[model samples]
Target: MSVSSLALAQTLLNGALLGCLFGSIALGLSVKWGHLGVADFFHLSLTLLGAYLTYSLVTELLWDPFLTLAVTVPAFFVVGVGVQYLFHLIDAQPFTTLLITFALFIVTESVVSMIWSPDLLNLRPLLADGFTTSIRLPDPLPRLAVQPIDLVALVCAALMVGLATYALRSTRAGRAVQAMRQDAAIAETLGVRVLPLTLAVSGLAAATAAVAGMVVSLRMPLTPTLPLQWIGVVVVATMLGGLGRPLGALVAAVVLMMIQNAWSLWFPPQWAPAVTFGVLFLFLALQPLTRLARERITSGRTA
Candidate 1:
């Protein structure tokens, strides 16, 4: 229970909390891009919008962090719907959707700069006063301190992911959405409304993004350029997590964060992201080989 050990433990806890926040944002992207066959390249813009809007409402109207959700969640959902409708109108191919959404990301970032003037903004912590508490460690050890707000955020993210997973598994609508993701034509023939289902899924994804954005705003400073940073991390998380699995996304976020943090401690800051990307590349290269091996084993068993 040395002071250095205590410090390292606290840092790990903090990293886990931040990792949850990353997963929260990635969850929506996983659903949209992984499940629904949407490119959803603008997820970062949606997050930045939520963060910026939360900051504005909290600062101007004296809204609480929770209350800001009333404004942000619905607004982002509507935006999601509108964006989907626009995409439908364009009738873009999958790669085209990626290009289109990336373009939208640029436009949204520009809009954010125009409205917020590229300034950094942060919301007041929701539980500013009672957020941090200390607990005594054993004798000859430094006391441990925890931030309740960070813990709360982590718990909330876990709950949201659990609820979403349950909904997808247990509800008729959720099952229908899943079916559509696999085969839209077949699902449509089976009485699923593909258009409405896509809209609902997109809205849900955007709502989750809004929640993540608000939490991020409370925890860190926001800027117009922040969305680009989130996009890069989220893309990596989504890929490493196997695309559609929320749990996988959570695990990937933690792994990536740990790698980055551990590397940064040992090497220069510039090398951290490179190290992380290298690890991700290795994972990506192995995925298809692993899948092929599984498929061959299954076929041999059948034979």
Candidate 2:
């Protein structure tokens, strides 16, 4: 197939927008995994729940879709706290939280399936056609363009990253959360109140998930279980971005999307995933080895 320059530009733009969406979806995962030290399998389910809530309220009650965040975020925040407390009650090890969260994921998925049905669900924005409007730049390819919705998603990604970065860096609670991330027992010894911090972090992550789900629903049609597709995005972007760093995830997402789209252009779409994962595995594998080598070199020099 002959690829037009305009078409390629459009493709790149789509990738950029998708990267933002994926980053936002993965932000909660990064938080819970990096800081809380919990294998939060239910993170995507929280996002899907947010979308379903927004769709139901906006469609049935005629409320503004974004306005639904007021409801979804807080509710999910409480849900996060409750789930965290349940984990605490079970005295589950950090790794074992993976199994607990998986159970939660299954339950949330079933609830969504029951309430929203197994069929496709979508949110209708007020400016549906307006979002589709693309701009043309004067040049060799006048039609090399992008939709406003993509830009909106990019902006939202920026805001989410910035907010998360600031929260983790500036606030006392956030600092305690970070402390716990580094070492839960050590943080507790320092009076960080590990459980409370865990609950707070969990709640904030869930609220972020709600925002991500809302942004996602705004951009495309969705299904109750579509959040599952986000697993790769969450894992790859979070690992690429660096654990516990929202800013890293944002930049990584953009880079990942750019590379993935470029690879797709020169190869079969199926091979693109192989390339994407191959790169991720190589990157992940090298990280620890490089760190170990650097530490050994430092020790030798000191000796």
Candidate 3:
């Protein structure tokens, strides 16, 4: 393959694969903001927390960081439940909740800095070293390169998607969660255990964040502040993907990453934040018209 062709192929493949990371990163925020109606500005902090916890445990106990999920997931679950209860107690408006979460994030970030100091923490998991795999193409195609860490992340993301689908579509508790998401009063009137279900969903969200962070940490260095950038990526993805639809969010995440990959060719990767935000701005600007068109189409179909 020609240089340009190979580069294009790599670009497309990475964009798509990288989106699994993106979608997973946003899963926690998606559940909270998209499903639970909590626009949690500090959702990214959960990822940071997950990364820090895994790193701390691995360093302290000499265990595979991957093995740390047994601890991280449960710890974050409890944290989420506690946070959700606080939100309920305050009966915070959306904007206020955003502020509250952001404040909590600042506090958490400070604690992390105090413990870990101001340094970029990167790890080369024993599992990821020399973990490259290549597949030969049959005649008209170029060989493709793959990484184990990325594969692990992709598999994890796919599993999360499956679990999310089953929970939202096939379970009674999931239905009640969705019902509450759409209208809390109506869901409660329908005998949905709104409080318990909300706590469960919030806990699920935090667990997803932990998984996302653990995967990303395997491939890169982490820091207390690193999740700040992730916030933009995941939030843009959540909105683009369809706030309340997990599968839709994954598809949208992939599409957005594809566009960002294209943008990267023109500019440095650092501009990714700008690219994502720009795409989100355009999407939001057009959302009202899109919603109206959809409503009209629905009415037409029914008529």
The numbered model that scores best in lDDT is: 2
A best-first ranking of the candidates according to their lDDT comes to: 2, 3, 1
Evaluated at residue 290, the lDDT of candidate 3 is 94
**Of 1 and 2, which scores higher on lDDT?**
2
Model 1, span 1-303: residue lDDT tens: 234665566666666777788888888888888777776878878888887888788888877777989888888889888877777788767788888888988999999999999877656543356543534445654565546656666876797788777877789998997898889899999899998888888888888888988887777788888876666567788888877777778778877876776555556778766776788788879989999999999999999
The most accurate candidate by TM-score is 3
Model 1: which residue pairs collide? none
Q: TM-score for each prediction?
A: 0.89, 0.88, 0.90
Better of 2 and 3 by lDDT: 2
Better-scoring candidate (TM-score), 2 or 3: 3
- Model 3: lDDT equals 0.80
- The local distance difference test score of each candidate is 0.78, 0.81, 0.80
Clashes of each: 0, 0, 1
* lDDT (10s digit) by residue, model 3, range 73-92: 99889989999999899987
- Pairwise TM-score winner, candidates 1 and 3: 3
Q: Relative to the unseen true structure, what is the C-alpha lDDT of residue 178 in candidate 1, on a scale of 0 to 100? A: 84
